[model samples]
Target: MNILDDLKLQYKLGGIALKMIYWNVACFLVSLVFFYSFKVGVFDFPSWIALSSEPAVFVLKPWTFLSYAFFHDGFLHLFFNMMVLNFSSYLFLTFFSSKQYLGLYILSAIFAGVIFVLGFNLMHYSGAIIGASAAIMAILVAVTTYSPLMNVRLLLVGNVKLWHVTAVILILDLMQFRLENSGGHISHLAGAFFGFVYIKLLQNGIDMSKILSIVLDFFTNIFKKPATPFKKVHKNYQKPAERPVSKIVVKDKKQQQIDEILDKISQSGYDSLSQEEKEFLFQAGK
Candidate 1:
């Protein structure tokens, strides 16, 4: 298959993690087209699309809580986030179901977004945030929480514990907590925090992911198509001696010729037919 067809095939066959990556890539492409400003060298995401710190904006456009996680501001932002996402998804899916993975990704994003907005408002800061950093961190942290001692190998860093990788990321975010992009840092930490809470709750027999499933089922049922009723007909069985005799049918000269031509076509393909046979078959078809 060609490149595009191959990608389509992969998407169709891959699990939730690959589908999530595809979604992020698709959203990034969309943002590049409609939100990015070449002259300004930045994306100009609207309040409805990006999560705004302002209570008024987010409160009015509540969907931004989840929508913002799908968009990225630049190519590098999308690239690194996707790389981490692929890594985290691989590790997370190792010990969890696809449903749980999807639930954690979505729920953590909303949880982080809410905390980001609250933290920003408390600090009297006003800004917009876009990107899957928060959600990606949650996935990474969630799996790390579940399996802290799991071994992970890095190219330049050699082998290390999963928790070590998670800790380093959390530390980096904490170190830059007040340096730059404070909102981004806050959201990342918040996501990590949510991830820990999610695992804890799950361990305690409280699967918060069920909440998402319940809500989704509710909406799905609301829009679900009703099944059409089909009538069933029961056939009566009969003994061989008691069954009606089958009728014999005779084919006309033209039909006999057509059947011979069809059998020949089936055995040797349509191309094997002679010129007269082809013409006769064509005329018969008409």
Candidate 2:
């Protein structure tokens, strides 16, 4: 299949894990096009999209708080972040649902971005920030929080506890906070803090992910096509034909499965479902 067909298939089958990765890659290509086609300087990307460290500029473009997570500064930047994101996505989904993953990701990014702005301003630093590091860090810390003792294998490192991995990373970020890339280091900590907070609140029965769900639904409804008003039909219109028994069973099964998925979403959030489960729900929606 072509790229479009492949994207459609992945979006329909690979669940949020695939969709988030697809977006980051797509945005990277778009940036490349914008860089070359627009003939801008090599490092001079448009500021409208990148999260600005300047509080004044940020106030004007609030959406950048979240948009910045989808952008990056270079090839290695994108690769490493996506790598951690992929790994974290898998770990996170093992315990949470896809919606929870997204909620944690987006909220962490927003929180990190805002804190980056505030922290930098306070520290007398100034620069724009980009990349999904903050959000990715959040996921890493979240999974670590969820299961501190979970062991992970590293290349040439044998195996290590998840908390050790997270702690080492956090320490590195802390040690570098006053050095180069202070903005990034600060944002990383902020994301880390939010990740820790996310799970704590979840345990306390306050799902911060619901805020994202509500926001997304509100926007979805706004962009959704308006429904047609009711109108009387002709009395002579024939009744609709009944579906075949086989089709009816399939339909009932689909609906029943969909209901179960929805209940899971209500209770534990969407990150709890397996990829196969997510794909089934995606197909059911169609």
lDDT of 1 by residue, 1-286 (tens): 2456446644654689989999999999998899888998888998899999988788899999999999998899999999999999999999999989989999999999999999998999998888999999999998998999999999999999999999999999999999999999999999999999999998999988888999999999999999989989897986657544333223366788888987886588655767677667555654
Residue clash pairs of candidate 1: none
- Top TM-score hit: 1
* Whole-model Cα lDDT of every candidate shown, in order: 0.88, 0.85
lDDT against true structure, model 1: 0.88
Please identify model 1 stretches exceeding 4 Å from their true place.
230-232, 238-286
Q: Can you write out model 2's per-residue Cα lDDT over 1-286, one digit (the tens) per residue?
A: 3446434754655668778998999998888777534454354557788888887898999999999899887788889889988888888999999999999999999999989898878878789888899999999999899899999998899899989988998999989977788888888999999999999999899999999999999999999999999997778768989867898888798789888877886578556777777677656656
**lDDT, residue 47, candidate 2:** 73
Q: Ten-residue segment with the worst summed lDDT in candidate 2?
A: 35-44
TM-score of every candidate: 0.82, 0.78
Error of 2 at 212 (Å): 1.1
